[model samples]
Target: MLSMAIGDRIRDFRMAKEPKLTQEQLAESIGIKRSRLAQYEAGRTEPPLTILKMIALALDTTLPELEDEGVPVPRKTKAVQDAPMPNVPQETVDMPYAGLVPADSNWGDPLGTGEELPVDIKFKGENRFVCKVVGDSCYPYLKQGDIAIFEVDPGPSVGTIILAERLGDRACTVKLLEWDAEAGRSRLKPLNEAYEPPSSSPGWQATAKLIGLEFKHEGVKMTAIEPGGFRSRQLAWRGFDI
Candidate 1:
């Protein structure tokens, strides 16, 4: 009874799909090889709810429909149960001290705080990096001790605040970048009135640009994935949100 129940349901569902889904197509979308899917369809092996969950999603169905009648489906971790998952999961990122950011991956290593933090995945980018704002150099936009996000770029546009360093001294500073065309050099200007601007040649390059940072960490609710048995989320990798 169990053998034919799941196998027949899978085949029927696959055949009923609009334009039809082949064994290979269904398998690949669910992250399994075609042959493995074949075994499940052939009733050669019993698929755990984990695999059944993925198949249900791919087929746009529910686990109860796939399960044999009267067969007790034991409740397991949230990984297999139907429940509203929390917005943020456990993630560790190196919220580095507000300071100079480098071009390479030296600062890329995760500074583990061992605390759970939520990061929205849509904002995730390959060149993304974050640093805490140190002083009032760029006050209004980036206050002291504020979290600043930067994207790695060799040459950021002029008039942009950037994480930069002087070539001769290699001294790092967060300042407004300006190009002096006549002098053929770069100027690192401070926004605060009390701070004096620095004059230097285009001997400096921007490690990254200040794209975004958090002024406040109000809980921003994100739309959850499909509503059904155990919805999935794209876990944000070790990163920052600001």
Candidate 2:
């Protein structure tokens, strides 16, 4: 059976809230084509990230709130799966206080002590690099201390949840990639409810590229980042929950 589209839910909400506002009007206000809006409402196409944000804004609700289904919500918890080393190898020296180790090492048992630890590492491979997750921006799917494996490649497709450097910032952020072809622009969309949508400037827009993603590691939930999938309670981190 076909799964229920989130578009349908969005349409139902829009119609219920603004019966007088035609689809064209709504589309105009939201910066999307009227036909595209119709496609979204009819479940023919998924609404782009921008449109989703616009809809949430127009509705005076967060994206998570707009997409929330009134059901018994599941608790956000992490379960320890079998910890395995990825194909990548450690790049640091065997001795401490040297080069950086493979990011995957943080997830593995340090010194095989059998004691769980909260840490992350960064690695430089011949062709790729990796960085572990250290915060809750991608909570539920990526725990506060889960180690994420990221490829060094900087080209990620639209809708791909990726690890990318925030435009004009020293810090990095994990968010979904949204590309606009006509405008030659893109945006960084956070899964967390607390984060507001980030727009890329023309300069950063051109160079901002996806580094990689938080690969499913042991002791981490492997849920995909979807609209309204994860919720945040605070706004401490720019892209993560406090």
Candidate 3:
């Protein structure tokens, strides 16, 4: 029987690394409400199994690590229990075609094709933005197929993985961010060692910026193809519930 309070353990885990990230940011990463996280941390409420799993994922820990003795059994929400978990990943391809410039199109008069249209995106507090991941840079943590939730004004600090955009590029591939004030530089590192190291060049090289991070939502499991075209892994949701 686990003796520690699961909620306390979770709170400790979150605070251990990201002391600067607000409760709201942590909640967003685990797909929960800020108030709910506060309640859990205060021992006013206990998370259900699904939420527990999401919290574990966000903290980079396992469910067993959050176990506590005398913790009540988790009850599935009525809606979740009634409806089957939606398999949204099946509706789209894992790796989409990139760099489809109009001039390169074999079809004459690409503009007349009427396929490309400009979309007006309205940023709202509740709306979620989907960002397509690129590069094998953050392998084992974030892969090419993963779609990260881009939360504007996330207010991230050091050691956080953010979605930064460069000049003429939509966004950057995922990388761990580190700020060095003494050197007047920010270091972007990959969890995978196979990728090239960050440059020691000058003149604001690479235009690396901090965007939002990939977050998983509880109960939303994504299916992703393995590297060798033989296996698959369920990529869990990594977004916060507003």
Candidate 4:
């Protein structure tokens, strides 16, 4: 049976794009009938893997992005001045903080509820959280003393940095996740070449994928920073909105 959540997400994704597409347009782009697309979006029909793939391509997103449990949509920040701000609509979302998870090890509870952090996200869902990094293995990209908010089990796709915990380990690691379907295994590659990569036979459990973190800003303004400044208090990762 098709869940309403999937249907809603399909419709949401279709409408959220710039120059929002109609059902008929999306159907034509995906090589499916408009009625079939409507049925898929209404949860009356479950889309097969092939159709899902076509939909993903038409939407300009990865397949995992479509099937993920929830999407992360960051809220817009307001100015600090007491003066009347512009009448801009903003959305607020809460993400759980799962305490500190190591970047060099594989361990941590993705569902842990140490605290909740409020941020603006593009996708609205309940399966997101933040965790502090305690190691330097992911240095130069993710830094120690920095925080990471992850979208829990948003499925897996190539080139995504993930928060993974081994089945029998007490620690978790943040690294680039890759899957080898033919070998029936998964590999965890670190951004820092100094650290050797690891692989799991049954495949590492993907608890979450690193979204963005809460960083301190000097003032109530959006400042740009280099990619290396992901650890900085700037909202450089805002590009993930795509």
lDDT ranking from best candidate downward: 4, 1, 2, 3
Q: What lDDT is obtained when candidate 3 is compared to the true structure?
A: 0.43
**Per-residue CA lDDT of candidate 2, range 42-114, in tens?**
7778776766866765543446755666522222232223222233322332211111121222222222333
Query: How high is the CA lDDT of each candidate model?
Result: 0.53, 0.44, 0.43, 0.59
**Ten-residue region with minimum lDDT total, candidate 1:** 229-238
- TM-scores for all candidates: the values are 0.40, 0.35, 0.33, 0.45
Single out the weakest 10-residue window by summed lDDT for candidate 2. Answer: 93-102
Clashing residue pairs in candidate 3, if any?
31-240, 31-241, 215-238, 215-239, 216-237, 216-238, 216-239, 217-237, 217-238
Q: Which of 3 and 4 is ahead in TM-score?
A: 4
Candidate 2 pairs with clashing backbones = none
Which scores better on lDDT, 2 or 3? 2
Candidate 1 ranges beyond 4 A from true positions: 1-122, 199-203, 217-242
Error of 4 at 79 (Å): 20
Per-residue lDDT of model 4, residues 65-103, tens digit only: 677757642122323232122122146466676777664
The model with the greater lDDT, 1 or 2, is 1
Query: Which of the two, 1 or 4, has more TM-score?
Result: 4
Better of 2 and 3 by TM-score: 2
**Deviation (Å) of 90 in candidate 3:** 14
